[model samples]
Target: MPDARLVDSKASFASFSNVLDARLLRALADLGFARPTLVQSKAIPLALENRDILARARTGSGKTAAYCIPVVQKILNNTAASSSDSQSTRALILVPTRELSEQISAHLRGLVTYCDKEVTIANVSSGTTHHLQRTLLSDKPDIVVATPSKALALLQSKANTTLVIDEADLILSYGHDEDVRQIFSSGYLPKVYQSFLMSATMTDDVEQLKGLALRSPVILKLEEDEDEAANLTQYSVRCSEVDKFLLIYVILKLRLIKGKCIIFVNDVDRCYRLKLFLEQFSIKSCVLNSELPLNSRYHVVQEFNKGVYEYIIASDESIKKGEQDVESEEEDAAETKDDNCDQSKSRKRKHRHKGEGDKEYGVTRGVDFVDVSCVVNFDLPPSSRSYTHRVGRTARAGRSGMSLSFVVPEKEWGKNKVVGCVESTKKDEKISARIEAEQAARGSKIKEYKFDMKQVEAFRYRMEDALRAVTRSAVREARIKELKTEILNSDKLKAHFEDNPLDLEYLRHDKPLHPARVQSHMKHVPKYMLPKIAPVAGAEAPADSVAQDVGFVPFKKGGDRGRGRGRGRGRGGKKKSDPLKKFGR
Candidate 1:
């Protein structure tokens, strides 16, 4: 296993949050920071000294200020580094998600403005376009706040400078190994340009990056505060998958948590859906995900910071490599995100300058939603380190917080690990049973109620797959029927129609009509207008005159059967005959 520990710890400041530099001090005072968090006090001075640093600190532990202070101080000391020009980016701070970057940048903006300086910090993350990030990287800026892949592509462009991979180990072990290599290999980052690696877990790849990227880099360590530790109350709940969501909803209803909170899910789509469900009860929520546009993701975070949204659903493990159900680079390479194999000796190797092929990785250590009041897990993280990271979002920077991790029955993590965090919410007999029953009930309700989301998705894909091949014959009859059934089953879909059910007369049928016809039309148009188009054009027209003739006729021929049949038909006596063919009856 790689040594996931920060090797060097020399503390000039007692806390990572301390701002010792005069200008930084002024900014801090202006921003209302009373004192340094342990990590900040130590990491800041080391960073100011321009060392490749690997520091372990929890979220809200003032880690951002720990790194931010030094970078801002460096820009103040060295005018050449802070440039408005696009290609001259002095500092590149890579975070795990766009939301974190936006949140941090907002804080940075406040500090810089108070210090009477103007600086631009751009966020490059999934929710945003690669093109925009490339443009920024190509043009360069004072500093770039980005996710690994986005930054790596820019760095690979050889628009090189300082590289600071916050949560270096997280990125390397989980997400963006290939991209990290590109950044690591992207030409010379001179001594004047600094490298800083910050994370709570010091996995080996991060240490290697520190050694290879920094020149005589300094190291710092901060111990968690005793008071903060005492203040935090940790606990867990054991339940089935369904119960977990219900537990969370009940927790919310009970108002057991205070301040803004973050709930960590394993997937982005889940987060999005959860946010919607929470909103039904008048609770404002937001989601942070890779699929959201970068700026949109950024703004959602801004809203979180501004307290406009009460809860933000964050999937800490989603963006990482190897961890996702989908195969990623780390998994492809037969490694986990926190792989500590091939850890170098603690005796710092002087800037080996190994490139991408040398096994690149990053850490998710630095990206955290600070000051979170509570952390609830939809599922236990892949490992203990991930568990810590999820819980770390709360109880950070000397602040007190609590956590509630929901462990579903038969989930990979058993009862022991899930209940380990709680000092008081220990495993017991009836509570566990209650929790499990709740989970089953929630799931049963969801399943029994006829909401088949996956089917809906599959149907969508099926239509896309089949629709493009619309042949001369009808392409949608089966699909349409299937979709109609699905719509009838879906609460979301049904609610949509009930609100606007084509308002057609057929929709007004006495039997709470399925309005299958109206639904089919409403599927294509407004509910009220469904009847106007659904009856098949000319279906109501006079019956084909030839229909009065022989029961059947060849499709292409028979010369307008209605016309033929009408002329052939005699009053009352003879068998129906066709006018065109003199058939004996």
Candidate 2:
């Protein structure tokens, strides 16, 4: 029950020299890590002493490196001390998702960059064939990363001396509790191995896991300081179903938002639907969900971090709902049945295989998206916890970020049945209120953003045009089509992509899924449609800069070529009366 505040804030990497190996120190320095994070400073020392640990820290707070450094250090020390061939799996790190397994493995590789020959690692949840994975496990790598179900079948656990369950709060919700029980209860490890359970939040499920895995462990609850919490600005805007599309189109197409953004939806169909709608406007964004191959999803995140893509339309469908959620959804279905029987059946059919999506795929929590400038909740999440994880993707590592959520009024739910999500939308006001209270309890404020929707009414036609093009048939087709394409890219053509670097660059995830009609005019905003307050290219600030207070959207007037350039003259050199030059007067 130790509060993390008592931990020494001035603890430095040099202080760990007594406990850490020299090679590990050199590797950390090579990675440009000057000082240890708070969790790292506290956990590393205890972990080095072989103490079982249950630690909680915020996301992107270097939790991965905290445990990894100690584990790698221990293995390095053991290899030096042992005389014989000590070629056995010494550590097992379990995660909730394949993406996280790969992430941890990559970080481990960096930590062992200078000592690669001495330590080896494998990821059993990498979507490779079990035969291939079994073959890989036969080498007895020093470290193994996997999800619980994957490890239950392939792991020979007698030789392992250390176990780590990353994202401990999520593992049980993903329906891995049984697999975990089977692994630990059925003689999966040595009797005296050290254990580490690391997570961003602690819940009853995590408390239960402490009993199953850890001994009398050191519990470290690291609370975020005020300065770190202040880095995020949360905003909520209430809009109709159609207005959500119009506002997002205006926000993105007008270049109001700066840097990379992640748009989160509640359902898989909504993910493809928003992507296809944006595609009509030629906005380049990749889709991430459980339906795609794990390798392709990892590649999408890699490309985004490398600045290859600016936006990612993701659905947190992989986040398993709790028992309360199940009961509420059943109630919502019954309510919908009386109002519209046919729509309820359609919704039921759409979700007949809801649980069939990859249980081991998660994006809202464990999967890190680097330098995310903003998070747009295209659909309100079902719970306050889900809301926290969605916004947590940004405002990380002391970086300032914004989260803008769209809340549908109770009166406006299911107005346009096409883009409507009945289950998640029906209680938008309630969910938003809960979210506000939760944030307020944490000393954070979620301001009600007052956006003048009338100013951007001009974009409604374009939104409508694009929305019509993305029909139900079109969305279904795009989903099937993208899955096939990603399968080819991830599995069938694995060797081909490995050999051809240029071809890999050309094989983009954001390519247009164009089963719908391509409205070329929608791609470019017309000059006459510019809002009066938006800044024109090469123009000074407008007199009414009140809109600047909105903060999330910096309205810039782009896409105009001749305005305020060359004396507003056309190609024929005729001095034309430029309407944009008169804007904001």
Best model number under TM-score: 2
Clashes of 1: 53
Clashing pairs in 2: none
Question: How much does each candidate deviate from the true structure in C-alpha RMSD?
Answer: 25.3, 8.2
lDDT values, one for every candidate? 0.48, 0.80
Residue 370: error of model 1 in Å?
Answer: 5.2
- Residues 1-585 of candidate 2 have per-residue lDDT tens digits of 223334454666665676777788888888767788888988987887889999999887889988999899889889988998858999999998888998889889988988999999999999789999999999999999999999999967599999999999888888788999899889988888999999988788899999999999999999788867866777788889888998899888876667789999877888889999999999989999888888789989989988899999998763244512444567667776466664666567657966656778888877778878779999888877788888999877767677889999988877786665546677889779888987999898886665655667777877887898889999999999999999888873357776776676776889888988987878777666766544546877756543443322223233333322112222243543322221111
- Which 10 residues in a row give candidate 1 its minimum summed lDDT? 508-517
**What lDDT tens digits, residue by residue, belong to model 1 across residues 37-149?**
67765665566655667676655577778788777766655554445544356677876654556666777776677454435566665344577667765555667777676
Relative to the true structure, candidate 1 reaches a TM of 0.56
Top lDDT prediction, candidate number: 2
Residue 145, candidate 2: C-alpha displacement in angstroms: 0.4
